[model samples]
Target: MPAVRLSDVAQDAGVSLATASRVLNGSTRVPGKAVAEKVEASALKLGYVPNAQAQALARSRSGLIGLVVHDIVDPYFATIAREVQQQVFASQSQVLFTQTDREIDTEIRALRSLIAQQVDALVLVGSHRYGNDSDAALTALLEGFARNGGRVVGMGQSLGVGRTIVPDNAAAAHELATALIVGGHRRFAVVQGIAGIPSAGDRTGGFIAALTEAGIEPELSIEVGLTRDGGHVLAQQIQEHLAAAPDDPVGESLPLCVFAPADVMALGALGELRRLGIDVPGQVAVAGFGGVPDADDANPTLTTIALPLHEMARQAVDWVLEQPDEGSAIGPEGSEGGAAHEAADTSPEGSAEETPSEVHVRGDVLLRESTALAASD
Candidate 1:
């Protein structure tokens, strides 16, 4: 059987094809209420399914928001995604989400796909790779998106196209470092994630800088993959190092502290430490960032700097859906109007554009059994 077309519905309802399209697409420009009701009834009776592409072209909006995240399975991303999903649905729109596994090329592809579909807005929930060739391409893509009237918002770092909600990783790590120092932890080891990643770098940098200012140096610092296995490997290496030099002053210290800037890595380290029969806070202490839900329920209760992920998600959704200001690049439809272009006045590629308006969220430092002071203190 031939597919039912918009004209068929219009004919069935005794209305013009334009009226049927306006009714089906829910356009604000529809003519009469009675015609709309008749058109709806005819579409239902005729089993008509509107072409999304055609409707988008006619109505100048897709009512779709695209979200790009790195590793949705990670609790950090999961927490924020949940809130973003809820807020987008509440606004009578749908979400198109994808995961990029922290790969810049993969992220760029995801952005391209979303832009191809002409998503009304975009929310990117991860750190931007800055000062690199890939960043320049990403910036160009975002600038084109902005020129076409699409709104963009970022969670971890600036994407140069729109507002960004950056957590103060450096500040939070410094705070955690100071707390550890005050808790009588003079010896330290750090299990750091891949270098150049903003979140990991900032946290590690801040902690080291603070400790250095206090006249203490880390006993060991190991670079590892940003994964559980990385943390597990670091734990084993720490044990080996201690075994090889049992009487070394740093190795002899009670409650030797180890900081992993991500909770997943910390949990992995904790598991390995327990398997080795090490007494946490008695022999070694573990601390982490990202107050994922599982942290509070862990055996020793993770000490961490809890990022305001849910709140950040809420603000991101709200900001992306906000109406474009007059004379702003965004068009009436809120998307880039189906073409890729760059605004002349958009900030330099790969650099943040100073928008007077932005949403800022803070992190909280939580002390727990995993990082408690030694008995002497």
Candidate 2:
């Protein structure tokens, strides 16, 4: 038997093809209940199955979503990726997952690949290198995708052409830093991640902002990489700085604290502090962001800020699957509309409105053995 088509269903139901199409597509605007019933009955009797590809061609939607991330190895990203997969699956759509390892070239390549695959939408998580310099390239590519009827959303920090979901990095950092300060730690060391990443900047800013508000001059240090090893290096630098002036009142007697931008980095800082015979919380307090599960299991449970990575991912995927505004061109490219294009084009004034789907889940400060009041006091 030949495959049943919309035309056949419409003919059998004594309705126009357009009405039959609307009914089969589950549109609720059909004029009457009886008409909708007739169309549905005709479709069932004819064993009609909508050709998804053909439907996509007609609707300009592939029903495929793309999820692009910076690094999968990082537990934070891993947790987010898992949530994204679950959310996308529930929407009756498939996902194309890719990782860029924080490399611009890799990110560009991943974007191109997703575009070629005709994904209906995109979700970018923790992409580091997007800004005005690459705006033209990103805009052109996203516009083309939109013109082809694709949507895009962004996750994490960075001005991009989509909705964003991110942790309240700045606020969380400020809160965590304040916790250390209230604990009587007057002298502080900060371990910041890669310089250009927005998350890193936000975290560092938060730490500095807190110190500034407390009337304490911030001693800032930045690391080029975002990893445990980078934290370890900063740890060594802190030790060296202390050694150079062991007899100084601030260096010898002031409570010392280290604020690592991420939990993994905090773990590394802990390792270095231990190697140098520094007692956690007893001699120096350590704090970090992104409360991964392993943080609790660490020798000294990490005192850190908990970012709801999974929830953020789930929300991001949900936003990406949402319907685009009617009559909105995909982005000057004549493709379907995308959040990425709008984000890219958003001006400083409009940025607050067009900022990608960021769901700022409040972060809690988790106090553990790793941080405490100064032992001497």
For each candidate, give its TM-score against the true structure.
Answer: 0.83, 0.73
Model 1: per-residue Cα lDDT over 108-185, one tens digit each: 999998888778778888787745789889988876676566667888865666667888888899999998888778
Question: Which candidate leads the pack in lDDT?
Answer: 1
lDDT of 2 by residue, 173-204 (tens): 89988887787778777765564577877888
Give the C-alpha lDDT of model 2: 0.70
- The lDDT of each candidate is 0.78, 0.70
Error of 1 at 211 (Å): 1.8
lDDT of 1: 0.78
Residue 9 lDDT in candidate 2: 97
CA RMSD for every model?
Answer: 4.9, 6.7
